[model samples]
Target: MIEAPLGDPIHHLLTPEALRHPAAAWEPFRHREGLWWSEVLDSWVATSLADCSAVLADADRFCSDWRKLGNDVPDSRLTVQILDSPEHTAVRAQLVRAFRALDWDGVRDRVAENVERRLAAVADRAAFDFMAEFAVPLALDTIVDVLGVHPPEDHRFPVVSAQIVDSMDYALRPETVGPGRAARAALAELTGQWLDGRTSGGLVGHLAAHHDSGRVTTAVLRNSLRVVLHSGYESASRLLGNALLACLDSPGSLDALSGGVDDTALQELVRYAGPVQAEARGCVADTEVNGHPVRRGQVVTVLLAAANRDDRVFDDPHSLRLDRTPNPHIGFGRGPHACLGAPLALLLTRTALGALAGLPRPLRLLDQPRFRRNATLRGLERLDLGWG
Candidate 1:
């Protein structure tokens, strides 16, 4: 496949240079114009913060379920992520109820336990890979604890999660499609059993109760749980890595947190380091973004990463301000399909960062940060650090 021209933001999105330094790469294209037509991807890319917000806010004209626009979306992808209005509202409620019903105190306690244990284990080391040693394991441990499910002793969670993350990048590289599908199938089956009361009682069991009461279908509960499980673990792991790197890159950013992990500062971290980069919505009716006519059935890609850095909405948009107020970044997204796990993800990050703040020494980055080449989800694949 011939790459799109260098000037195209989509072209540089997955390149080695751009992946390592995406903020700089994206900075040049974040204009008030906000929209670009990409023949290679056959989609309209929305860049400006205002435009991206407009597209997400008006779900009536732009539908998340591209199947309406002739794309073949798999059943596995049919959770709250793709649903439109009325149905989206109901299905989202089922999942949100489960989230709200969580033992929040227990959740915080468990996350703190894992963070402290991991920090202690690596405290004596001269240097360590934060991704491998801390973020990944802590994410997995929290998943099992929160879900209250016992794995078959096969260490398959991370393996499957990797396939799913790769799948997000599949549109750019077709090779990952198969493994992504297979992993989803395997995960769906496991979640099915868990949601059917075959596994230990936790979030799955709570959701299964909803299914039993005819509040939701088996497919809805299982698929929704599966999606939550995948994103809950993978998104946290990636975001932690990204947020840490962001803190270290900005002088005194870590010191600002040494006082305490305030919600305002944590949110600034979310805006600065969120892993989500883009999401495509199909046009259900004729609409125009910033006076540019978008025909029905056309694909509109929202460049959320670019929007986060758009100077139109943020002052000194490139700087990391721990107390940046009124931050309206679409990191967890917006609209009827906003992220259902936003609260949980925030809780996990807030807890983790709070622990780091109490460490006796200053956090240090051992080397340059390395990022994954995924287009839709941008995050670090490797982060070596020393705070011991």
Candidate 2:
């Protein structure tokens, strides 16, 4: 039996400062081996790629349960993200097929139009919160198009989506639950309407078609759709926001990316600033990791942000080098559960970055960006920026 490492896991490893500033906070433990406890979640946190890879690959050993993190709100399981194994495989396959078969060129054109329109609407301002003005709408519109959701122009999709995503934060205060509940309710209602055929050839249509063929049930379809919308839109939106900020923070890196740097360079940016930080998994049965005893029913959280920065895998782990090769970073995760939306996400990020870079004046970060409090889905909550 491997004895627990001595020290207050949170204090010895992660500090409040680190929790708030993950990039800086993760520097010390990036390459260090072993698991540490998180007072915030009262669970063991794995920061190394090897450990994360070990847990992710052994899905039977480490299960994924959002409820383990206290996300027991009603309709929580509607999202396919919480499912595992046989059920997970079936649902994920259906989702992947539908998502991949989407009209990507059409989607890209629509996104570009949306970005231009939104930016024009806000261009008059010298500086504004990019999250609210650009990223949120871009994400919301993309999801609305993908999910085929249609409501009044004054619809609340964006607000509700933000609330649901925000509720996943580990540091969520009691006050935050109200908004989260509202978001869940809104999503449930919207998903129900979509199920009724008010939408078109979007995620809803795919699920509905599958439901009619006995491929999926109405409940599973609704829940899965909601989960996809939440994961697809909210997380990607935050990542785009952060990636833009990262580019602005380091112009040299941005230049490399914009100057048609090779795929290797682009891969580094994705590794260095790829969004979606820590992912949660629950142990299904007793197992030993790195000679340490991992009992069944215990929760394990894989810190992607920390893992990507692990010195064992990356040199100058903290710095963003577009040319960094042998980049085995798990930005999109690994194993059977790897993100199915990776291609779409890459297209969206690439387009957004390319658009921002072409602007006449360089974009400037107006303030220290704020991060969403959720430990699992990491990204910027608000990023203020301006361009001349």
For model 2, the local distance difference test gives: 0.69
Model 1: residue 70 alpha-carbon error in angstroms: 3.5
Deviating ranges (above 4 Å) for candidate 1: 1-6, 212-215
Over 241-302, each residue of candidate 2 has an lDDT whose tens digit, in order, gives 76777677775656555654356755676687777777777776778777666776777778
Q: lDDT for each of the candidates?
A: 0.79, 0.69
Q: Which residues of candidate 2, in runs, are more than 4 Å off?
A: 1-20, 65-75, 122-124, 151-156, 170-182, 212-215, 260-263
The estimated TM-scores of all candidates read: 0.94, 0.86
What residue pairs clash in candidate 1, if any at all?
none
